[model samples]
Target: MRNSIARRSLLKKTLTGLGCAAVMLLSPLSLQIAHAAAPEKDELKLGFIKLTDMAPLAIAYEKGYFEDEGLYVTLEAQANWKVLLDRVITGELDGAHMLAGQPLGATIGFGTKADVVTAFSMDLNGNGITVSNAVWEEMKKHVPMENGKPVHPIKADALKPVIEQYKAQGKPFNLGMVFPVSTHNYELRYWLAAGGINPGYYAPAKGDIAGTLSADALLSVTPPPQMPSTMEAGTIDGYCVGEPWNQQAVFKGIGVPVITDYEIWKNNPEKVFGVSKAWAEANPETHKRLIKALIRAAMWLDENNNANRQEAVDILSRPEYVGADAKVIANSMTGTFEYEKGDKREVPDFNVFFRYNATYPYYSDAIWYLTQMRRWGQVGEAKPDSWYFDVAKQVYLPEIYKSAAAELVAEGKAKAEDFPPASDDGFRAPTNEFIDGLTYDGRQPNAYINQFKIGLKPDSLL
Candidate 1:
């Protein structure tokens, strides 16, 4: 009887210990389930170019936003925009920091015939055009001056004389932008053509994609991070690129940033977060969660009248991030922009993220890029405005954004007052802030295109 009791007691103790062990092992997981944390697709690899707008990714990782949702993310720096896009399409990267026009261009089959989409816009107004000191010295002659300072929103007409000089010398006045399909390319071309500089054309019908057809100033491709290097090598006279590259030029004292894209088109959309359609489809919840983190990061970047800008600039300067000098990053980030040495100007909108409804991907913004592509013959055949609408729908995912935004409100991570009302339309109010005095209404895109003195209109395709 004694042996029986001892054995039973021992068995009872062992079983109790096993139950306790099970409870301990499963408690954390049960809490994860109870909270409905992010899924088994927790391990991720995201890519970014070395630019300030890549801040969301950096901030999310640094602040453990990804971890809060039970994700372990690896952020990689891409070689170039093309390589980055290719990686996203081929599933080499789960997603990436993409040019505003990349998904639009890719979806329309202009460059790579991939079905890419963006639900999150990374930033706004973070790019600028910079010229070598030598080029600027000559261009300064034509630039309008006030109080001994060059009047800003300086038109490319100022550079026309310099290009003429280059032409007279039997040399091409070369410039650089990150990609041919990039907003920098379009903005640079728009600014030049607006100034009667003839940025030239792309005659893909003739197998010429150099975009220098009938060109006054020849624009070529230079990777964003390499813009300063190529210009410093004297390979190109000037370049249009995003920050801190423009600021990088200033720091090296090799080039001077002439104007920012904010001044190009005030509060314009810049970079976006792009994922393959398949990834978004299979991982809808994870995708929404990712957007939530990014949206919070965007808000944080712009909160308190941009009080966090210095902190963000420091984050961007880290060697693993943008890897540029902090001063270079601050030239634009700190809300004061330096043109020539000691000729600093206050530019409050140099790097907008959450403010001005920037993170929302407007259908009209997508359409504007489409119009530029069509204007330059990227879209070879003329289609109705409905085609523009349909293509814009495919590329920009405002519906997905609405879902994520609505969820953020429901979860109380963000206030209902922070975003547009549930009945809010995708279009921003008509903007008259363009440098050239053109008004843009997202609803009337084609009419706005028609207003342009240059560029292909509805009737001018042939």
Candidate 2:
């Protein structure tokens, strides 16, 4: 493993030098208008989990966008997020569809200490929290109802009393999330915290990464595909996971989805197209080409107000891709998320791909993940606001995204208006668009951290 890493490091330096030389040779006008150089590595293997949000990658490959860039790409479905991220770090896969937190966490040495970065965010708002039928039945008594149906954007307060009941009976209330640093985990924690429930903390300084200190509810890791089965088998009472899995629970008649991450934070960033920094440095042109193809794929996914979503659903249902039943994937992919068996509602933004600049990886998105990491105890020490900015700048590469978008615009493939302005500082404007109604200004990360009622505030140790 050391030798392999050493080899990648050497190749990265060589490629970096070559890229710098090529840039130096170009005139200012040429630098401004030039398309990407020919790919250094064209035949690439990319990894993704069996989830509907991996649509951008599948669409890129299936629609020949990759081939259009003189690249031959193979898309493989990994067993889980760990396998997918590990394969990318090892160079076994050039890149992968990753959790938004994966690259940030890896860069900060949270779980795996590796320099991972993302230039393209795949999709947004594709996750939902679902509880087993037994839990939902108990929770429904406390949920506000209108016309014999549970209210939308159900709060975790409804589940809080149920957890208390389990505690009273001397039973542990277990909830599953995909990974510790996953959006699922943070979203679950956010929902629980919003309702005044203690979701626990991680004391990594003391080697307790379980995140269960002073906990009312215990959260654990379960891969996306196994969530429904895990809940059905009575291991976990509920789970927070990405598409098809949450919908799978409803289809299997084992669970009912309570709320979506959209309800938690509107238009929240979800999956990203991530590669090792070594791999990215070693394959700059190939990386840019890859982003271009994915950007095109994202445009296709959200074209004409999702007119092409049915086709996207068809492609994502193949055995090589998500491999779920088409109807199950379509339950959320095509715009309506089924909460209860028949309580489907129109959540048009439930799965956003290209619209709202979803593909542009903003620094604010990276900092949001870091804030959550700090809010929980994954980040053991408090850092200055500049530290958060520096870390986000390291992991989220909006410059590369702009390069890809510029190339597309030069080629008449995408419009300039569809992207953020060149003047965008990569920090989104502050807004109180959360289920808890607390404002988040990415520029003021510590203040945002302080706004939370249940998380560890600045300088607070577990």
Candidate 3:
């Protein structure tokens, strides 16, 4: 009987140990569940520039998506990209709709030395390059016309001779981009370089950040809302910017948009939702929840073949948001773009928010921006492929994005198929859809940079 009692005591201890092991196994899930609870901070303020691509932020606020996530968000419009980024860095704003390049630029000390991170990519492909009427009239002479209309995807080759004439007359062919590190600057530079015109360079190492060191066409900053008027006043001959400023130019008859960035680089990533790294770290749960709400907002924007775009346009027309006329904003927002007066074309993918996995913050997207920075001398030195990968990983938090997306899927707010494939390594397939017809694989940034006939070479420095 004593032996039987000892065996029973041993079995009891073994079962208790197994129970303890099970609890340890389940502990991680419990912690994750706790992290997904109510946000640490709910009432928030977000900033954005007054551009149509800022639609996702507006949609999230107006559609009650933030409220659904228990976030009371105040959406404010900053005067320009610089102020918006500065405000976020100073913690005056919780986050902001930022240039896809902003977080990368800030982190790398291009403009500001701040550790900023983006968990969400806002939208893609909503920008155009426009020239004043006189420049367009001059360019028309060189452009090939078919049946009384200039051919589509008007190459900057036609603009080359015009710049030459300006040089001949001792006139500076001045152009404008939104900011130094903006996509507008790079796209304008890319288009000009493709056509054999040197847009310029930046030598931060030499204390010359003007970016016009040896430029054939001088490029400078002009805020989006002022693009049309600046060109109209002859302060700038042309400008590259996002809508509805480009469309506003068409409506106001100040200039004509020659090429969309969609043509420059098809479906290119645009803006992102950026917060200071400190802010993100301090409020991890809030950041994830905010991303979830933004994802739902992006889905709503692109839903039903963009049947909701008109509503978005209406909402954006309010003075507090984009503040442009509804008609001008609709010119590009509703799947059509007016290039020249009376020349409307169907460009359904002109402003993609969610489709094509546009909302996913791909490392490939970040790498492409870094490549442009190096090509333009903003980086001032060549970096290895692994360096680009490291910077991209540091700025873009795909783990946070995935967790947010997973929650949406579990709650039936989104489908698993709607996101990047579970196996995606954050790199997009190589694409050659640029107007220059050169292929770019983010994995091979150096090779891609070397292919450019213009801009700084890997071995060449200012």
Across 323-359, the per-residue lDDT of candidate 1 in tens digits comes to: 9989889988889888887888899888888887778
Pairs in clash, predicted candidate 1: none
Q: Model 1 clash tally?
A: 0
Model 2 lDDT, full chain set? 0.91
lDDT of 3 at 87: 98
lDDT per residue, candidate 3, 382-441, as tens digits? 788889999999999888999999989977789999999778899999999999999999
Off by over 4 Å in 3: 1-36
Please give, for residues 58-138, the per-residue lDDT of candidate 2 as tens digits: 988778788767677777889988888999999999999999999999998988899999999999899999999999999
Task: Name the runs in model 1 displaced over 4 angstroms.
Answer: 1-40
Better of 1 and 2 by TM-score: 2
User: For candidate 3, what is the lDDT?
Assistant: 0.91
RMSD of model 2, in Å?
6.6
